[model samples]
Target chain A: MMKDEFLKKLRSHLVKIPEKEKQEILSDYVEHFQHGFHKGRTEEEMVRTLGDPRKIARELIADYHLERAQENQSFVSLFRATFTFLGLGFFNLVFMLGPLIIVLSVIFSMYVTSLILLITPLFAIEALLMESSLLEFLLRLLTSLIGAGVGLLLGMGTVRFSRTFFGWFIRYLKSNLNIIKGVNKHA
Target chain B: MNVQFKKGVLTLCVLVLTLKKDRYGYELVDHISEKFLIAEGTIYPILRRLTKDGYFTTYLSESKEGPPRKYYQLTEAGKLYAEELIGEWETFNKGVDQLIKEGLDHDEG
Candidate 1:
């Protein structure tokens, strides 16, 4: 491929960085191609030697955003990190995305379960007002209290679990960053 | 070399190579790629990271044949970092070697 076409392909694949930095990176490649040409190499040889522009961009983008996400722990940085990881390869699609969705669902369901449990006592009181027997009312109250107690415990567990999950995910993504950078063969 | 092992070693290699003399992007790429079956672009990200971390500083110099080229020079921090990393690798390498020797001695017995 020609220099312009290669640079265009690379730019298309790169996620946004600041414009000046983007220029700096592209200029480095431009220098590479320029030097190769001066050394009597063909554009095809230069491009081939450089390897896949998309894959290179993917590695840089994923590693950069993931590092930022780790340092900042901001939602925006994490969203960028996850999105860039999805662009990486089939491995990330299956391993990263699958677990991310599963963990989110688990967290969500735990929250719903806790809310339902905590509200049960209120509903039981309403049921007693509708002419239920004293024994039935007492039973409902007792069961509702037990349900709420379990719910509170589960709710607290969910909080702790979420923190642990977030930490593990950060470490997992950090290692995955190594794979993207060709530091690790597999993550 | 294993890719994981090479990644760490490559950083050290780059530092050692540039300790006294600055090297350009293609120069560094060619030097390392000659020994390892690496994609030439792999070293660029490492260079960028090291530069970002203040281990290396970059400058552009014009050549007679073409456009300017960017060169990487190790900084004071980079030199210190190289020393620390090299020291750690030596300790780790000796420990691994000793363990391997012990295992071989047992196998002979």
Candidate 2:
């Protein structure tokens, strides 16, 4: 019966406040009621001191508006932070990827150049030593293939990390949206 | 008085008063009660109905003593509505006055 009265009063209070603010006021009062009960105040005494339900509802409605205004100001700040974090993360990925691509390209080019340099010398040495030029050329080509495979692995690793970071950020945004919807439904 | 009739007129009165300025629920009750012998409980349901209808909006202001009071104010639509009601009331009063005067004159004759 008391719970019903409390909910009735609470709904009356909510009518004066905006939907978003109403939940906040309800939670605050619920907490206060719990704390007061713990302090050994009898339910009847507590309700009496709280005064008429209609009157208390009026007061809570006023406080709800004030609190809502404060929350809106903070919401603007949080919005800025969210955008800033996303921007910084995006730029950080760009910075890391740019250097990674450039380094990989440079290393691959150097490996190709070194292979060309080594092959010419190797063929010349094979010719001078009367070894088979074709055998020597084939041996140097296999070593160059191994070097290119290692470079490809390193490049793939950099791309993998970049993708992972973006995926995590998208997941975070989706979860945050879900949380907002849940709160709205509850309100 | 019939509950429906009282409710309709009281709602109209509240809308008219709130058009001038915001008034606390209790103050509204007291103001109307001074003129009509209506129960305090009656005003609350009317106020809620008016609020739901968009004729009135409510807010709370802090009181020096005790809890804050809920104040009701008329919206723009409510003001327009009140003006039309006021015009109709004036016409009805004038007609009633004329009828009463004629009746008194006939009685004298």
Candidate 3:
């Protein structure tokens, strides 16, 4: 086979593989044919020895599918982890952390900027005079306590998010190793 | 052997061997021919097939004597596929062995 003829036949055989992979496969064989030519084999002799391209193409296609399947699996796992992390972050901010931070900052501002110094004595006198007002102060204290609780929940949730992402990554690595083992056994 | 059968099995065998390490094209032909009486040309198709399938990936390394030699190595998927084929081969060989033994016994009787 002429060098061009050999490449043409090989290209036809490569139709089953994805276009990018087909190019890669062709280039390797092209290199092989060139090496053979340099070693004193004529292009015709090299092509003849390489055998039927169609049969070669079929087998190559099978291998390509297997590889693609493995890659697709990993990509799915990665996507799942990414979505999970994003969901958790959104939930934490919207439902848990955001409210807690707002409440805590409110209480801190009230504690630091209270202008009720002389009025504090009057409020203490009123505490003795009116039980209903004292009950109102207790209710406000309870709301601040709930704010602290929400802050704690957000902190714990952030830790859990990190752990889940790491766990997913580890699973991806293990599955990849198994795929490599399978390929090795066939080889 | 049927051409299709030979080609399929030869491609698998070449992929499996290349998994352990890289081998130049001619070296692969010589190694496989030592075990199976095949035309030197047959190995190239198998190599091309394996590379196309993604069972093996190839690169060129400089050679001392001539042009750069193309060396093939097994990719991860190729390794896994090789293992599966090896397992299937073992089961096939066991079944064939039993049948062969039965045939021999009948012939002797």
Top lDDT model:
1
Which lDDT values do the candidates have, in the order given? 0.76, 0.53, 0.58
The worst-scoring run of ten residues by lDDT in candidate 2 chain A lies at A174-183
DockQ values for all predictions? 0.26, 0.01, 0.16
Better of 2 and 3 by lDDT: 3
TM-score of chain B of 3: 0.88
Interface RMSD of every predicted model, in angstroms: 5.5, 19.6, 12.6
Residues A1-187, candidate 1, lDDT per residue (tens digit)?
7778889998887767667767877887887887778778898877877878887787678667766766665546666777776665525545567767787789889989998998899978997899989899899999999999999999999888876777677767655433323332321
lDDT tens digits, residue span B1-109, model 2: 5433344467667877787689876667657767877654445545654565467877867767544567788888778867765665555557668989999999999
Look at candidate 3 and tell me the lDDT of residue B36. 72
Q: How close is candidate 3 to the true structure, as a TM-score?
A: 0.46
Question: What shift in Å separates residue B72 of candidate 3 from its native position after superposition?
Answer: 3.0
Using all chains and alpha carbons, the TM-scores for the candidates as numbered come to 0.61, 0.37, 0.46
Q: What share of the true interface contacts does candidate 2 keep?
A: 0.00
DockQ of 2: 0.01
For candidate 2 chain B, the 10 contiguous residues with the lowest summed lDDT are: B1-10
* Real contacts recovered, all predictions: 0.31, 0.00, 0.24
- CAPRI category for model 1: acceptable
lDDT of 3: 0.58
User: lDDT per residue, candidate 3, A132-167, as tens digits?
Assistant: 566676664555545555555555554554445445
